[model samples]
Target: MFDDRASVATAAGMRLAQAGVRWDVVKVRRFLGLQAIEHIEQPGAVAVDPHSPEPMLYFFVPAGTLADWDVPDTRALNSTECTTHVVLPPGHREAPPGPYWLLPPSCGLTPTDTLHRALERALHRPDPHPHFRIDTAAMRADAAQLIGDAAELPESTVLPQLVQRLRGHLMVLVPHVEDRMRAFARTAETRLVAQVTVGEAQRRLNSVPGLTFISEIKHAQTLARSVEALCRHAEVPTHTVAKAPAPTVGVVQQ
Candidate 1:
């Protein structure tokens, strides 16, 4: 029975592949043995027979593969079991349940919610530092030194627009930093999300050693709000951000 089920699943996967549907195979196996015989009456539980090498196989396939194919709504029969399947294209209804034994073409196994949750968890870790950290002062100093050194070099033919190129390089670095941060954040837990936000204060503080200043404070605020909303939806606590302290200047005494 198990071998037949495995064969059927393999055949189904091959059919999908031949039809130009890309997918990954995940296998689920059941065994019936002496112990299984003792508890064979349990519902939804399969018993494996130790003496018999063969067992039963049951599985599910992700719905995305059928997005392009015409799939009937009715359940289909496999060699050993009836299979319940649904087709869900990107941005369609919520994902269906599964130990989804099959992963369809163009449909990576990672679910959107699962990814979001993982990112959220990663971001909420006690450490706020991004995985990759850059010293802005050091970078700027290096850039200035490089440019100054280049200025002294005899014009080795036409210099590729130095300043413009340097500026572009910095622009590229900004996104790289953000990408690293996001990636680090995603690895936290299966529930975190992160968005970079730039604020006037953040902009002014860009020169600060480890601070990150992106586009606007509003964006970060919006992300925080979104996180809060998600927490509410999940019946989780909303995190609060602490306000910065006011700064004061001291006068020199004669």
Candidate 2:
């Protein structure tokens, strides 16, 4: 394992060794690998299999680092550890359809002791973003306003409770709308490709199971038509409802 900050010419950009000389490959789960990489300073060459069943990370450490490597949920490989060689990308960039370099080969090997400590920390450290929750405060406020307006109307045909339910549905659907709006903004910027812009939109839209972007938009349109009819029947001005700004999505802190 590398100790001093000395740069070595032999290790720079070197590919996997020939049959005789080799390096120990430390295998870690993707998330743990990310955590370990972030924690380690000057982490040496790292490779990733993005298409694997359970995506993996292969850290290139000095040969024999596995002899005393005792980190949990991580495996080390070498000629003596049931494997002779590991396949690696020929170059360092985002090469798809196969394992690629997440961090290309550099000056020195990853320190075994540092990696061990990083893996332990990765296992115990609290995740900053464990999950996501919708911020429905704005929707709730809009529902309250609609309810209050309905109460002031003479023989209001609209049920105040319907607004609450609509708000709940809209709150669920707003994220989809936000995603579309963002996609439009990205695609319209003239700098970004529309194809790439749609990726984020697709990810957000598919996040909720059984919900699709087109279906959500259809439901939102139905809700809009229903609300318009209610407002007309209740003698409420359409202008008043239109004046409310669109509700925004907020990230809740852990």
lDDT of each: 0.27, 0.49
Model 1 Cα lDDT, one tens digit per residue, 1-254: 11111122232122112111222112222211111112222212111111224322222233233333222221212222324322222221111121111112223333323322333343343432234233344334434433334524323232222322222233324343334433332333212332232222223222222123222222333322332322232221224323223333562211
- Number of clashes recorded per candidate: 26, 0
Indicate the residue-level lDDT of 93 in model 1.
13
**Residue pairs of candidate 2 with colliding backbone atoms:** none
TM-score, prediction 2: 0.45
Model 1 ranges off by over 4 Å: 1-129, 134-142, 145-158, 173-243, 246-254
Q: By lDDT, who's the top model here?
A: 2
Each prediction's TM-score versus the true structure: 0.18, 0.45
lDDT of 2 by residue, 1-254 (tens): 32212222233342444211446678898767776765787787777776678778887776666777678888877666454655565554323345665565543578778888888987876532322222334344443443444433212234323432452333233332333333232323221332333343333322322245444434333443433322222221222232223334662211
